[model samples]
Target: MSRLIKNLFALIPAFTYRRSHLAPPVQEPLLANNAADSTVILGAGIIGLSTAYSLSEMSKQTIYIVDPASKACVGASGQCEGAIGDFGVENELSPLNQLSYELYQQLAEQQSGKETFGYSGMDVHALSSHGFNSSDPHLPWPVQEPEDISNLPAWLKVPRGWVAGLIANQTHCARLDPPKFCRFLQKECESRGVRFLFNTTALSAATDASRRTLTGIKVLNKGSKKAMNIPCKNIVISAGSWSEKVFSTLFPSSRLRIPSTEQQPAQDWIRLKIKKPRRSEAGTKGSCQQIWLSADSEDLDIHMSSFLDGEFYAAGGFVDLSDIPDTPDKVTSPSHVTDIIEQNTREFLALGLGETVQAVGSGRALLPRLTTNLPIMAKAAWDDLFPSKTKLQEHSSPIAARPVGDDSDVAGGVFVSTGHYLDGFALGPASGKVVSELITGQSPSVDLSNFGFPKADEESGDSRDN
Candidate 1:
């Protein structure tokens, strides 16, 4: 089997367990002779399936979802360590993120009947020994007045804030069992007449005249590698992290010139220094056990859960990235990953947590790597030469087209609901509904002009074609 296929199937056991109670493989296709439907969704992740569910409920058109995976959510959505807090988007809490939180609330209530989509309230605590960097030239924020660090310890000189605690007390974020959530949406969509084609790979999207609109897709059966062509009126690209690949094929020129920007909000480049406890004290119940630091150095985002007086208390530090890198490869260096983890571990040591470090795990994020320590909701016009898209206001000129803009200018009917990043779990429902409105030519319940297509006049200054 191809390496890709092998990796996909290897995840089936884990995927099946999370979504449903299933026996071993049946050794048969889920849909042997089923035919394609009208509206085809190109992914089986939360975004794709959620989009399908919304379309199935709001329109008369049939919906079909195709994925190259052995089961649903096996990609980024299924395996993500689901944490649904709003701290990252606090600065840019657009209507999009707000709506997402609401949808998650509704799903929580509905799923209560079956205890499906295991949902829980997440408490967030944004801690920092030192505040954000004001003079750092790379930061997007304007420098404020200088302040004194003389009274404070050198390490704790950075200002600290409880951003997460405030959000939890005020906004109420929900944590989801991602696998369960994906399955719930899948079953719900299927019940509404949306068909799923697991293990079915879509190789390419074929467009009609004008070369701007998509007409159909060329796909293959994963097990047999047999190819087929399925036509459709619309296609929603929900392939996460890998989305650029699809978009590149759709707009080769844009791919070469414009480039899909990296969405990781932080560079993951903080340094970590850990001091191991003495082995002689290992057998003691409570020897000289205490984590201490200069009180200036702390990672605000990484939390440490510890046992204290029969209760659990969490603490950590925060250090924001200066800007969201435009290329994943640029920010995903080994040192970058090591720095983030090390910094996080350093904070744990400072807290005097457990003696021996238990474990560590990390992965790429979907959210734009942030520097302002807040969510971004602005939109800007497409400019290939600019190297980056700006998050401007709703009335900003050159309104940003949806990420699915590759064929949107041609399809004229296409729209997208993405960039939720870490907010995907909270915002998927609302985003799905809004996208449905755009797809059906109806006004969205929310004001989405910030994400709307730009007018001809707005494009006048654009000497670029992307």
Candidate 2:
């Protein structure tokens, strides 16, 4: 029944934008606005929406989620192909990932009933070599042998053991219709009294000097070009790639200037910028464009296999830098999408896969990266505070208040939750919950001290998650 509902939900439109002047269709529950302690959320992507929903439920705060796009999740999150798995990466072991996974399961339980969002499971299959020819030479067939399990890393190893037909299984991993899920989230938030401001662009945030906090935001109604100020007690900058821009506007002079040490004697100030660098090197430049493969029923349970016609086919892996702009926060170009499909087709044939599957979709995402590939998930340092505020303030520097060594107990209010890259969907929920816990001044539901990213000094070397 859930599978049938999932199939039916696939037919529903993910989102439909209503102009600023035009109100959404009258739905009683959707019209409720009990949020009083307003929280101005910057973006309407999955993370922002999820956070907004949770905040509304927990605090009943007047939550206002605004976005310039016609509807929520129209950005990177909207373009997703619905792959939700941790892949057991070291960075994914944090409490944020676990919470996100749990939250997704809960959301699935609600929507999987009558309002499917393609909430179905899948299996992660491994192949030793890039090529294998079986009955269908067009497809790269998996080598069926118990010994093959030895090739998989310990982290990816199955619970019982790997057999010829199946390798390992991630029971909770699922594939979702990204847009539909976004819409469902919006609906759920609205049901819980969160107000969504569509077609609204947050130009900038105004601060109250006396309070030493954000006062409100200036927003533009894209349709009428009218500007309005949305006042709120708190502002959560949930913008994805656009976060750096918002932070830059809020704190223009923010920079990480480190004096060069003995090895490299030079002093320079590196601007705090967010960018999505292409995953390509000189020689390996288009080597891993596309990927397509299949596992057996044992690898993916019957429930998950239903996502791929009760088989176990998955494809559409292509890497292209053409659409990625050097500047952050810009939408990936359609030309990049074209290249994705083209290169994906090439990889399909190379892997002996006959033709690209229509069920498969491709999208791109940008992940926050430190110099060493690990994420920077710490409170902004006191020295990095707003120039005007820090100049005359007598409070302790944000640097001094920074957590001693990756300990979760950092400064209050401010938090960091980026760096999922391609796995944000699999890990966004719990990350939001942690952020909520921090905001509410409660012990985090999960322990996050060990794997949490830390604040580093100039003398400290870059930290790698591997």
Candidate 3:
């Protein structure tokens, strides 16, 4: 049934936008006054929409989401292969990843009958040259050896040089269609009175005279030659890789800067629709399995998964950051990146399993750090925003004491939630929930000490908080 729905959706024109299943048709033009008294959320991706939806559920305040795209999930969120797995088991972010997984399970339960976001349990296999072994302690999930290789699908032909494969506990991993999931979130937010300003670019944040408190944001309507200031009590920057650029423009002179976030060279993937062979012909059930492959000699890792419609997606390879232009066209895939991914795909699946190529694409994500690999999610530092001790002490009390208002409040407020890197989708829900807690002055559910901003004296050139 889900596959049928997906195929129906695939037939729609690529440029045609999906309407909100929950919100009423937007009847008013996006005016500054419409956002007055709203909690303005920047960026309409998964993080931004998730935060907005969480905020709307908790607060009666109007919610306004701004994005340059025509709809949500048009950026990295859309490009993601929705593998909701706790891939951080051996790292500092393991707890957070687990929390996100649980939250996703809860969300799936809540949206049970109304919509299908392509959620399903599946086994994830890790392939390597070392051969299958259950003794690997680094993998958090239980591992088991397959009974025989004869039962495996024909498309999963092991590479010539690889000898080992381990399957993760089937309960630990799940899959969803990211684009569809994001649209569901948008619909829920809209039903909760969230207003979306699509095709709107947030140029900068408007702060008070002291530059301590954010009053509103300056936004430009890309469709019309008009600009306006939308008064907001609290502003959350969830703009993914572009968060730092937006933050810098809003507070150009602040002593604390979001460390340079670099864009990873793009990764490309090809989607192919194939005809499933008969069980008699393939000698098996013909189930599509997800595969992860890595070898000691190869620095790159290959990830492959298949959809219900017999469409397989395979992605691999990396490009040098220096080779990409600052404002390169994002809609088009780079030839070099595509070529490398194609080569990797062919090497991984040597059987040529597909009947027709459906789509080819690439994604370049901006990571918060090139070093310690931790996401930044906290309030802007006082000293960095207000260097003068006298001014800091003078405005500190009032800024902290100001009460929340419908339109705008004087209390200083600037929050950042980015730098999740490759785990953005895996961690996005939890990140948004935590950021909302911070904005609302509620205690965060998780200990965020590791995710906080570095003190001025201890700051390094890198973005790592540790």
Candidate 4:
């Protein structure tokens, strides 16, 4: 038999005892739309799924999600270490970051995530390597590991000169398999009547010129080029890295652009997913660990995490930006980047051999970012873009009038919620909750006044595509 088959046979004993049967994969082979559905969520990543989950729970309105990919979370969401904490906490995202922590706990209970998605507290560690230029991701966040390696997870095996240090992140986070968590959210959303349209592209917004409100979205099924106007009272652009393209495509005539003028370049990453060693009775399994692999001085390189669900995820590839693929589906790992990361991945897999855990899958993601590394949550100015996911009163533009629901005092329907750089998985829950509240006429749970797009007129003169 082949080596892969032999490895699988060796792992079956561990798998039988430690691995839980995941539910049948969620499917969306057929596309469907309803005119009466009041909301269209673009992108089916963590943010979009969370938005739909929150919307269904709060308003109980039919929510439709559109994505250009055949499957959800084909970007960063699919590749992250699932470290749900203050890893990349920015001042603007602080509230949502903490709130998402708490929300994860509650959702874990509600969804049995601890058992379902392998939720458990994660121990954060920073490691230094002699292999590259620099190792610390939390620049200025000092290294604290002494000569003692006892504090690290038993499954973690570092090289001779490498040292491991702990990060004092107080938030209670755990192992969250992105695919499993998203499926859980999607399952919940489906139960709440949310519809997902995969392999679909949102072309633009349908507006009421007299009222300055978004009445619908023009979406095209990529499989057949069959376009349909999904009538809705509101829209949320939780489109991740594709936010710029989504915004520009939806408003080719607008002066507004995502990231406005490109404050920072985006990086590319490759993800290595492998079967994890079963929990050890030796007691070192304390909390799953988020390992930051860095050298004495490279800009950025790698990060990894092992989970309770018998799965391991590690992502670290490059420090440069590239052209954003037309869609997340088109993203592929460059050969050079993969070469750099695979050495470490192979080492990690070797470390797990004592437990018989093996490789399962591998993938890539574009880490779209800005100088701030926070998501945009704003209302599109009436004249330019669709005010997709905003509260009417707080963000209405000068031309704003009554929205589709006729809230009477406010107008605008396009709300933007993207640019979540690296924290999309951690921040997704609270982002969804707040976006749900905003679109449903409730005050947002967290203040997003500082995020999102500038008014169309304010965004003129310097607008450049990301």
The sequence of per-residue lDDT tens digits that candidate 2 reaches over residues 102-215 is: 677777786562246756554434332323434522222233333354533221223343232332344634556565666777788878777777666767766654334555
Please provide, for model 3 over 425-466, each residue's C-alpha lDDT reduced to its tens digit, 9 standing for 90 to 100. Answer: 777788788888887778887788887665554344433122
What ranges in model 3 sit over 4 Å off? Answer: 1-27, 30-36, 113-115, 129-147, 151-154, 159-164, 209-212, 261-265, 275-288, 295-301, 320-331, 343-357, 360-371, 381-383, 386-412, 456-466
Task: Give TM per candidate.
Answer: 0.56, 0.62, 0.78, 0.78
Query: Model 3 clash pairs?
Result: 37-406, 37-407, 131-164, 132-164
RMSD of 2: 12.9
The backbone clash count of each candidate, in order, is: 27, 12, 4, 16
> Please, what is the whole-model Cα lDDT of each candidate in the order they appear?
0.42, 0.44, 0.58, 0.61
Give the lDDT of residue 458 in candidate 3.
38
For model 4, residues 150-258, the per-residue Cα lDDT tens digits are 7776666777887666653325445566667767877787887787887889887877654556678888988888987777868888887677778788877665677
Provide the global lDDT of candidate 4 against the true structure. 0.61
The residue ranges of model 2 lying beyond 4 angstroms of the native Cα positions read: 1-36, 85-87, 110-115, 127-167, 170-172, 255-363, 366-383, 394-416, 447-466
Tell me the lDDT of candidate 3. 0.58
Candidate 1: residue 104 lDDT (0-100)? 72
Worst 10 residues of 3 by lDDT: 4-13
